[model samples]
Target: MKRSIAQLKEWFRRGKYPTESQFRDWLESYVHKDETVPVSQVEDLPRLLNGKFSTSRGESVEREAAALRLKFDRHKEDADDEFEKIENNRQALVAEDERQQGEIDAQQAQINTATGQLETVRKLLHSGASWTTVKAAFDVLGGNYSSLWALANTVKTFLEASDTSDATINRWQELESFLQGITDTDSLTGLLETMKQEIGTAYLNDLRKTADELSGIPATYAELVERRARGGMLPGTLYRITDYETMVANDPEARSAGHPFDVVVMALDEHTLSERAWAMHSARDAAGYFGKSKLEAWQVWYCLDNDDTRFQWADTTRGKGVIYRLIDEWGNDCPYDFKNVQFKRCNTTGDFVDNVVDDADWPNTHYILSPSMNGQADMTADETDYKWLYTFTYLEQMQDVRDASLINEVNADFESAYYNKACNCNEMQAYYIGEFIDDTTFATQALNNIVLSSYDEENGAAVKMYGNKWGAGCFNMTFHEHCYGNSFGVNCYCLIGFKLYYNTFGNDCDGNTFGNGCWYNTFGNSCGGNTFGNDFYRNTFGNSCVGNTFGNYFQYNTFGNSCNGNTFGNYFRYNTFGNECYNNTFGNGCNYNTFGNDCDGNTFGNYFWYNTFGNECYNNTFGNDCDSNTFGNSCGGNTFGNYLQYITAGEGVKYLNVTGGSDVKHFVQNAHILNGTSGKDSKNLLTVGLPEMSTVCRYVGQNTAGVLKIWVPADLV
Candidate 1:
């Protein structure tokens, strides 16, 4: 409402001023002063020498407001500067954030690349790829030391969880340490390859041998056959028969009269002959008689170097004769040639070659007869050196010839060195070649180290154990049979491997399986699934036993019978005793403590039936009257006696020396006193109740009265 002197000048000189009537109207809004003042007396404004001036509050108020506006403008300018400074700080913070974000993105990218590389290495290792292949892959995708370390630790954890052998784990640790300094892929590969070689047969199969070693070289026939049967031989293996004698000696099942020895597995062609280019030819002509049939003379002649067989004895004159081509046992081919040849028949029974008397006499020579003229030959020439020719004939008295019929017959009875016939002896089986021995007719002694042929259902090769009770010490024998009610009635020791079914064992057995629904009428060792009649040690008997009663120490027999009265030894696995097993006496650690089923009146040792058979009977003396007791290492489902008339001694009570109902008496210390009894209980090897607890205790059983007394240690003056 107030106006200054400057305002009055502006109103007088500039267009910002209103008209005089408008200014008087605006002045009407302010208070008027009575006296008039010169503009020169105004303060904080330019002094104006006006002609006349009326004093009013509008000038003062206007001057004061203009000064406040100037102060407000300066404050606003300072606030704008502060805002600019704040904005600059914000821009700087944003730039810093962007720089950090870039660094974070780069680190994240590296992390992703490392993670992918580790995953690739993990997959490659898991696939069992060779170390070389893995190294190649690692080279392709750069790997780090940390990734390899993580992979090693991961593999170690897997091995530990799998219960790998200690040596194997140690080897892995050694390999890890060996490669710890190297992170280069090629270096790791080289070190791993060296380690692999150092492991040797620990990783390699020992059965892989050289080709010649596996081939049946006359001595290794049995070993090769056994190895082949056990899947140790490579598939489609071919055995070489060096000669006829070797073939006959090694595999007698492959022998036949007159059957080509080398042609069984592979046929001998012209390439098999050493000098096939010579081109030999044979011609048959009428000859003498060998026995009942007439003999035909065979004239064989090999051509000369020209490769043509001229029968006129001109071009084919390398060797020509009515010669006997003889092959000896050592696979030697001998052709006897002369000017001419003739047959001399004789009724002798000796070697034909040994009788080389001049064509007039025949002494030890044997005449061979043939069905046709294909097999008879004799030299009538006076050759004194034809004495080694042995004759094979088809006569009943002579040695049977190696022919096709006999080979077929022998082959029909054998398969892979296992005889399929029913033999009445045990001589050959001792050597493990008699796989299908018919022991029903002849009882043999024990057998050892024999691997019985596996049962073949399709081929009816089921091995039958005899019914007669024979003592057979079968050690390290593997009996695999598709058990068809075959009982092993032989007493055997170390009857190792058996997967039988429905077979009974009648004699004492060890480590065998008496099959399902079979009764074991003998003492056994770790035998399973048989109804045992005799005392058993570590045997799990089958159901439905007949007349099975045991009295001696039944250590670990689990049979389904009434275990009424029986004693046991230590390591009693279960309290599963027999039904009707009352009045049973258990020694030391009988597990089935509570009277089994109906088992009563049984004396038990300490820790008899503890924490078993739903009975919390720990070291207590007795269990409840009639509870279902689990006979540990004994029968499963059989009623035992009741516990009514039995006083089970506690841990200390069993070995305690009980006196007459005296003043609370116990065999305490070295000296037995009446009431205030105390000394050193030196009954145990360690003497207690001494002045010093660490004093050595000596066992001097001076007190004869406390012989069966439990030593009660006490300290008194």
Candidate 2:
């Protein structure tokens, strides 16, 4: 099987074939099993066949074998190389296929999310055609719609452009407007599709993107509100996004001024934009705490039913900034901002009524809080107030300051009010005379239920106009009952004061003192001689004259309001003159019986009690009834801001007589003492009414501070 070349090569390397003929026989034997049984070996054999052995060299046979071996090795190498190349190509193709598949998968995910969101938007839009509903749905989109619309408009503008002019851009815009004009819900889709066909896929894609964006943005608006809401957007205001190009195209002046012409705010909701008209209005911050609390935040303001329609806002134009105030009714601590607060007027309805809301014409809702209060008040903004606003319609404006250095001359304003003459005068007096429209009725209620100097509404503010000594002396008040609003006393007895520390004559915040020109705070007093305090106390079930809501401090005074003689447990401190006794000798606690009304000018020996404990000897003479005619916890407020207070040991604190100048060393404020009662740990109380801690001084000679150290004669005891 060896070729001639192979046989020749083999014969050249080998000295000789064992025999030329043998070589031929061997080559012939190997030819079938191996190729390249060389022609060289065959030629040698033919030489041997033609003539003698000398004709052919054995080298030919050796060359033939070597050639055969080389051919076999080259063939094996080629086959191995081809196999490796094929395997590498297969692996590369598999990798490329997998990568392409991953890209396709990502696109599939995008489509899924988009489909879900589009479905949600569709559901919201289908709910209603009302602005409220649409605005609610728009909140779900956050604000992405604005961006999308901007992008689409930009494209439309570019598309409308011609090579030389803006003709193409204008055409694209006109097509958009035409599409917007399709009002019939059933035909909207068809028209959009038609427009899509005209504007092409590029523009439609942009529009879809914009709508989708608007459907996904979060809501944001008004600042300065309480922050807490977390629902999707509450309500969305409609904003007209003006295209800058069109605005500039229409108004060259505005464009040149660099004034904003795009994105105008309007009062109408999204559903109202069939034509472009804008009206800016202010709104409460819906996203604030009120949004989160839902109903609780709405309970703070008082209401004025549509009863009194006398006055109106200073301005009557809508959409202008305005400020208004809510005032406490008449019986309210007049000038004292009695729960009244100022606010911006953001809403109103109906036509303006140039009438005044006075008590005579107050609406039915005009009412006053009951004197008996225990817990929180009711929460109903819809309730009709006993009163109404002077007027109910108007708008406001803001004054811009062009120069900071210019001094603005503004008059300082004070609130005031007058009440019915049937009431005794309150220490402080002021008035408010804005259109009573509704406050009049509320004012009447406030004055009606108040408790002043024994002046009951049934009896009047007072029958006689007492001179100087009348904390209840304001009987024939010159001011008309419904005349104005201010603090002339008689109403909410517990007058609130705005007195700053520097105010020597004004009712300030640093607590009122005697002779400082401030009035007393009677939570609610209607007349002189009025003695019942329904709101001052309370039991565990929340009922009493002066509820626990207030404290017990009768500091710097010697008597309370309304002494028609039915008062008890009331306290007194600095001021004097209402009791009947000028001098008392016998201890008064157990000595007095009935007082007040007809018992005045009574006298007794110095040994009798002048004011046992307000009714006996603590501060006055005598002339009050004895139901509980003594000062105690249920009578006054916690004492502070003054000296001398708390002078007893039984319930509130331990007290010492020290009447005979007998025991000054053992009767001071804040001194714990031993109880007279047996078997009880009697040293927990501290007395409060003297110059120092005399309780400690009582045991200066020994470590027995709280021990009972004073003993009086049997008669004195």
Candidate 3:
């Protein structure tokens, strides 16, 4: 034994690269030396070699897979085209009896193939064979079977038992519901983990117990792995009752070995064994981390999963973030790495080495192993065996050519505008710096040349859509203040000076949340500014504007916005000629507004009492002197703090507003009680006189439900 060891060392020092058979002979000799080394050292030889050598489980697997893949190439290729043709024929009679029967036959054939392959997986896993033997089966598993599932515990690794399965969907449903009741389902990531743990602990155990109660299904060596030696029970293959992390204390998943070496893998195009293995690589790439395991310096071997020639873009080769994994499936290699490029590599350079030996039939292959160009005869390099083992491209690099089948080569008009470009640019997604359609007509018109709204075709009843081009889902997606078009145009929204429109600028002018045409959320220059607009919200959700108004005018059916939750108690003044605001919602009550001064062009002459607008009138301050105008010109939501003045119909008043801050809720609570004044004031669009509520009530007001306390005795202090 010592002499043989010296000879082997001498050979290494001589730089004489031994052939595989020679190396195998030397290894066998060494193992038996001294009788071979000690029993303990003999057992440790494989690990010692694996730890020190560049050759890894992956490399071995690639060599074997490349060889095995050839035997199944022809059958797999035929299957690939057949499936592709079937998939492409959208109107094919796949649903008909004969065609369906044919599909069934094909699918059954594959299923049988998969079943045959499963035996290999079990045989390899049980024997603790190299990953090459194990993955050779998976590479072709999907292509060989109609189903995409892998039940390694089934007969010969195929779906034979039928399990005639006792489905526990209802039980699963109940368990999910139970977990949801106790868990914060809102935290998706956390909840998923919790669900995984809970399901394994409870429902899965129950199912297993039921199986045991029923004398269990057929058992295998895989089943033995499913149970712990201790009293604890566990699921098959993947999980354990005691977390491996907790048990090992040592982290076995640290992969900081440096960048992985590329390896080519061979497999049938239609979910061939190598293809399945490649998919596993992709899955691993996506799963950057696994529980506490750090995946680093990982190489992958992906092959054509669909067709030998055709490749579908999977994604990037490297990931730079943390991804979670709870299992060490495939012994901690990347799970699914079916990069399309890997397929191309195999097809181009790989010789269909169906097995270690070439055969005529596309019968069984060992695994996706390939012949190394410069290596010993009949030997394949590990790196040249699979897909993910090769370089992967970035998404940005492939952006131009990705899925370009529908690309039409049409010439763009030199000086014409298209509908897709109507809104500044086609995409209004976040971070885009283009000029948006929703904005004030005063400023935006100077910046952007195109106008969103248009002049009305008919009597031009304020062509609401205005110059704005209509998009499929662009209703109410406007910003009045940001609109740079002609503000004085007949169709321009609100008063000329004030640019008021829903989504007035950008996509945030946002008045469409309410009922149709209800534009109270429409603010002039302030983007998200309205009396009750853009306030603080509750968590992710916001309070809805339901019932509200400074005066009795903002109701649901009659007005545009909701006036339900106004904090100001019935104080509908200082609106300075805003109109038809039905459905306006106040978070509380509407109060303290000076509904006294510029109540111009209002449909009704109503006023709220006490604070400012409410300070003067107790009943509903109905101001009507000039019989000149209607709705938008009506005097509404005025302030009494500013001295009462005569505002012409259609004119707006700003004196009623405060620059820094105003005590909007000086008088009432429970703002819902203040919802009274009707929007029925059409007669005197002008103020009758500058008389106080004391004098007006005596001569000019109606005896409706106790005047001051008539509508709401609750709001009056």
Candidate 4:
């Protein structure tokens, strides 16, 4: 009934096993009936069952099974040892990783602490700490001496680079001195306190003085009124009284004796008065300050209107007596007596007369009224009246009144009328005569409002005379001449001239002549002239020269504004706007160069050189030579020179003609012929005839003409 080992082996190969009930019954009945046997040993039961069914040659079934078990156990033991070793190694790696992470965290914490300390030290260094504090901290930290010195230098550099005041610099210098010494923190602190105290004390002292310095003088109205009323008179000081009422009240004896009060106030001291008080008092006392005799007739009326006590004497009197003594001396009637009469003064003689006086009666004097006295007349005079009747209404009108006797009489009359005898008699006479009258021939000549006149072979010629404004005249042999009102050529023959309103050659022309509004600036007997506008702005030599001529015999030279003249030349003739000709002749046998508005004339020869704009040229004759000239607006002249260059004129072929010897380049809008010739040979002529495009022509000598011309297209070449 038991299964053989061979049958069992067959069953195992064929994937067949015994039934659980059969196996259990067999184990209970034959192997062992003990339930204490471990079920883990059941795994070996199958191999034992296989061994029992096997046929071994030298061993039993039980021994074979046991040997197989021992081999399996050894393999299991080796795998377990390998797994244990792997687990131990994994645990050891995990501990090492944890330790490394702890070390990293501690290192990071130390670095953070160092960074915080460094930041703290930076703040202390930037805060302008004293040398004592820095040294103490350095010593405590055991810092290297070199590193501490470097840090101190760096801080010093930083502070110096910053915007430090003078006081801060001084404080830093003191700190440096202390650091050089063996000073402690306590000593440094004491020194700093002392410096602060001294600075504050000095600042307070400056502030007090500044307050006092800024304060100005303060005045009162009561003091001003008292000073004005007193007329600057001191107590018991004698003074004149012109007012009849005041004379009657203050000096009854003078009033009864038909005299004005000329006595002291007997109360206040004028010397003790304030400066402002004295000024106000002096202003009010017109008779004493301005002198009673020097007062004009109009001044008398003005004083009366202002309630001046000096003029009050006239108010108390009647008829002719009512007029102020100043008016009587001026040869003028009272304003109330002759309301219709126009009071006029002789500008040459200073004599007052009625407007009804004939012009011929005052031929020797300028019978004109000042602008201030013109208000006395009912109506203003016309030009004719200004010449004949009211001759000297303006200061310029007296320029040609050259009668010495008349001038003396006029001066005397003015002195008597205004009580103002001139301190310098010669100056007064010069003012009246206008020029030094050594010759008597100019005593009768008087030009009145004539625009142009020529006086030849006359001893004394008064070109602009008797209220001639805006007139021009010339004198040839006259010794004394006078011009007025933007006129030219006054006071010829060794007499000084006066010019006004941009007038050229207005006074004293020995051998020079200039036009109206032309500058008479000559050097070495040469005619260097300039024209100006309404504002009289001149063109300078080197800047914006319009029309100026230099050198001798410069004729018809027209420079635009302030053009410079020739330096050395005899005949710079017929130059129209030719400025700054250096030993050059312009025009036809005339040394002149015509430069356009704001152009310079640096021409060197007697040739007709006309430049429109800023053109610079050297010595060359014949056709219009515009070399290195920049044409801004239009170029309409014949240009020929060594290197005649033109730029931006017109877009066609008719405006500019640029003919030069060599290297003649033109970028103009339209050019007629760009002729670049080296010599007098047709073979060396480079002419570009491209009317539609701008061309650059050069002498290449490739062709028979020895020239190369490149034509660039209008759009692109």
Candidate 5:
């Protein structure tokens, strides 16, 4: 049986195209195999094609043929569209593959060139050529070299002139093998030029001079000893020494900060000559270099430890790391004399003592030595009778020593000492100087170490402890108005600065101008000017509340104390302890409105008008008999000029104009009003808060002209 039109169409729709034999089978299904058409009736095919068929089989043939033709055409169109899409996709993939392959090929080229250059440099270094010498050879080769042979031969010639070691000849043979293997001239040229540019050409002249006459001196230790024994050179004459290994390692551009041995040395006496020569040779073979290349020197030798004594007259040339420097002008009887002491462990210059940290009483650690301490200059002054007493106790105390590396080390050591009881109590007590207390480091250390001096009216020593966190009670203090209790920086006559204020529990009150109970409270430096806050703690009349009167109680029932010309009335309980109704007038407090520090330009009348609870409240005018009307914390420009009682305000509630009102429950808690007011005895009117994006306005009163009212969204109401 033949397949139907529906089946063929379904097959075509699912991307199954009919073959030639299948198409023939489908065409035969429309017409019977036995029903043969005569040659006379073949003329009627045109009539059938023109849709003028009479018989049902003829019409069936036409309908089925048309349906099959349409299906075939649709299949052809779909196949053509899919073929175009596949071809386009294939092209795009080919493009992307070509792009990635190009990058890979370029990267491989770079790798090959780098490998070749590395092989070249390896051979050069193996020949006992220092990086500086090899670099100089590449510099002489330059970019304008004509042939590969020229480049190779020039580098080899420079190497021969630089080093006479057999290792250089052997390594040069390896380098020659590598050069002969390089078939490509372009690759060789690129590698050599790159090496030259990277290594620089700064020391071309130095290399040339070395090549000419080899420093005009005996280049070897054996040669030097032979020449000296033959009396070719005198004892006091300076001679230049070379360490080949040091020169190879002398690349300061490397991470190790290389030590170059290019120093000028001379012998003192005939006995000491061999020793000095051996010292130089042994130092090179063992320790690499002395961290210095050259030094100008005038030496004076003396016998202390069998000819181990020399005083250097000249100074060091450079300024970092370990260096032998002139310590003092004195020559006390010691082999390791004060003249050429190595300032090694300090990571700074010898002037670190005089210039940076000039403290006569610096504490002892193992790293620093004191050679000028004991009475006797003899070795029998003590058991370990070296003049120097090395110490590492107090680098944190040196504020001028800003080397973060050394200071970080000191901080770690200090922390360990605190835990280990290495820094004892008396030593820590002596560390309570002005600079140490004022700096950034001791603040954190003060948690465990500091024991402040009890209230001294003479020097105000307890008050100057800036950034001291009161973990324990400050100086056995409990409510006695000490530095941590209530009053800080307070003497018998005047008030000094109460610097430290990180008090979680203690009341850090400062007695700057006043005698006893003047509180220079929290984070407020409240004792600078002469008249801080006088007549404090019950001596109320004529109290001079000026210049850093933080929080002092001046109580008298007559003429209130004036808070005038105060730099910072910081945390100043402004006549706040007692009912200072008559004699407490807050005068000119300055600009710093910190945590209720200074209530600048705030007018308060008699009988409880000037009671500020909120910190940093500015320009609030409260009328007389308006007792306890606190403009809440950070509330600015609020006018409560009437009979307003018990009005506890909110944060940042600005410009609340209440002309004449009494018994108002005006609890505006974060109600950010822009020039709004309350009616007489107005109760509990909440300004609706809204989402930040909502622009709608909801006001309590009518939108009157010139009376600017702030609003929130209506949906919030």
Candidate 6:
């Protein structure tokens, strides 16, 4: 049987060479044994049998074989042509694949280069390099001019807010100028170097200044006392009564009496005591008891003695004389009232007694009466000359005496209008000038401003301003309004707003913190903690949101904003709404729901979790555990979960849409009806076959009111 040409073509197409036995059978049929063909013709026989050939009658055997040979040659030529075309096509395909792969590799290389450049720029920015240096580096790496310009502006703003030093300000100015005039990369590099040097030096100076400012000053007297008690030295010296006694004992005349004297001494430092002694000695001649000539040695004592020993001086020579009577041991007093009494060298033996006369007939003129002891004697007679005589003793004896004279004098000085105006006096100086009893000038200032008030130094009346600006650690703050605690608003002006905590404000605004802006009808907005927003009309949590704009009537929402008409219930967290959402209502615990622009009129019930709805999806209802439900654009009247419909069927009947619409309704098994809507009487109601028809037959249908009604069988009822 002759094989078909279709079989040969199929074999050639499949690249299947014929078996040797099959090729031999076709060769024998083509050539007769009697007529021996050439060896070349026989070798070509197998090639002839492998291709298409024809066997026709009424021709010689050779002619017929030759015709068949010609046909087989044409088939073999066609097969070679087909093979060549297929090989060429395959090569072309391979080349095209290589070309695509090369393009992809090139794109990947470019992406990697871009990523590396971005990382380099980020590292440079965080390396504390100046903005100019970073910009220059970016330019060297072929960064765009607009990005460099933006970076420069950002750096300028950051530096201005963070650093207030003259060097920083000057460097920023220079950098701004350099950026504006930048024409070449070389100039930019030079500018970057200069800016880096300036910033580095300024940073060092800032550190130094911070260290100095943080090293606080010792301001209180208690601190000085504590330091001295610990055997530590203070910046200034403190004097005690024993120091004064030691100085008096060192004097030869004061020690020669051989008996202890009762003395009340104001023991100040040597410099201060010397200044007071000179002022007192220069005014001693003007004292009433002293003669026209200056005393060889004048000692002024403020006698804190008992009433029995104290005596008052009587007026004698108009302005120049005062006399105190000397009583003897027998109670006999001196004659002439001891007129113009002056202490000469006493003839007595005791330390203090040797300073007085023993004889009653001698005018008893030896000791100088303390101005405090003598009523008629002027203590400030010389430049109110004896003002220290009264003030120094008053300050020393203040602790023992109730309503001490020093307290009245100091309070009087503080109450004076000229107290702050005198010289360039600070608050402490204006109040404490009277307390410096060693200085006569301040004593005069204190005495002139004396006022009779019930307030004493221990009470609130003696409060004085000590420092500038109110803070958590300041003292003596003035002009503070609505302030609390010791240091709040110490030196601040008009701090009258409410709910402040260690924060300073430049202007007034209620219920906001740290940030400065005007809020009109906003509430519960905390601008502290780096969350900043301002100028909200009637939105709650407006300033509390981070980088968001809340329009009017936006309430009970947080996090992302630009929510114009979205009405949210309480407990909404991390929800973001675009500007196109209008009249969208969210229930409690509705979190992580992102509504795109134009998503309007969507009502979400409680616990609507993890849903992402597209834009323009209006009138969509969502319920709890309705997880991963997505709505397309313009999709409306859609109900998700079985919470929105009524169903009372067998176990398999899960979802039913009573109100028919083109929208898709999605629900899970075991879902039941929530609140249903009014619809047709008997729409597409689905039921499932049960195992057995028990006495109970439940069916879901619409009642006369067109609401969903579940009916029960009579036996089950």
Kindly list the per-residue Cα lDDT of model 2 for residues 1-717, writing each as its tens digit: 354645656664657655677567556656546566665656567675678554356678778889998998999899899999999999998999999999999878755654556544444334324434544544554434443344335544554455644676577567556444334454434432333343344446667876844542222222201111222222343332322111111111111112112222222232221222221111332333112221211111111111122112221222111111212111222221112111111111111101111212312111212122111112112232211111110101111201101111122331221122211222234322234533453221111112111111232222221111112212111111111113333222322111101111111111111111122332223322122111112111100112111112222322222222222222322322243322221111212222222122222222121222323222222221111222322111112111112223222221222221123232233322223311111232222223443332221111245443432124353
Q: Better model by lDDT, 3 or 5? A: 5
Better of 1 and 3 by TM-score: 3
Candidate 4 ranges with C-alpha deviation above 4 Å: 1-480, 487-584, 587-614, 622-717
lDDT (Cα) of model 3: 0.27
Q: Candidate 1 lDDT, tens digit per residue, 555-634?
A: 34454333323434343345454444434444444554333343333445333444233111111122223222222222
Q: How many angstroms is residue 335 displaced in model 5 relative to the true structure, after the best TM-score fit? A: 48
Cα-lDDT of candidate 4: 0.32
Compared with the true structure, the alpha-carbon lDDT of candidate 1 equals 0.32
TM-score head-to-head 2 vs 3, winner = 2
Candidate 5 residue-wise lDDT, 248-295, digit = tens? 111111111233333334555543342232122224434533322112
- What is the Cα-based TM-score of model 4? 0.23
lDDT of 2: 0.27
Report how far off residue 139 is in candidate 3 (Å): 25
lDDT of 2 at 387: 18
My TM-score estimates for the predictions, one after another, are: 0.18, 0.20, 0.18, 0.23, 0.21, 0.18
Candidate 5 error regions (>4 Å): 1-80, 92-405, 410-547, 550-717
Query: Can you write out model 4's per-residue Cα lDDT over 1-717, one digit (the tens) per residue?
Result: 355555545545656677775565444443234445665556677676667444564468678889999999999999999999999999999999999999999879755655445544554434546645655554544433443344445554544566588987887887565355424443444443443444345446656665633331122323323544667534543222223111111111112112121111122365332211111122344444223332222222211121113322222332122222112232322221111111223232221122222222433223332222232213232223332211111122245422121121223233342222111111000011122234422322121211111111132221222222221232211111223323233333211122212233333333322212223332222222332111111222232331232333333444433344433233444444433433323432333234444333233323223333323332223232232232332222223333333332221112122343333243222232223222222233223322222354322112356444333334353
lDDT of 4 at 79: 96
Error of 2 at 412 (Å): 10
RMSD after CA superposition, every candidate = 37.2, 25.0, 39.3, 37.7, 27.4, 44.7
Worst 10 residues of 3 by lDDT: 240-249
lDDT of 3 by residue, 234-348 (tens): 2221211111010100112111222221122232222222221111211323333232222223333332112111111111222211111111221221122211112111111
Q: In model 1, how many backbone clashes occur? A: 54
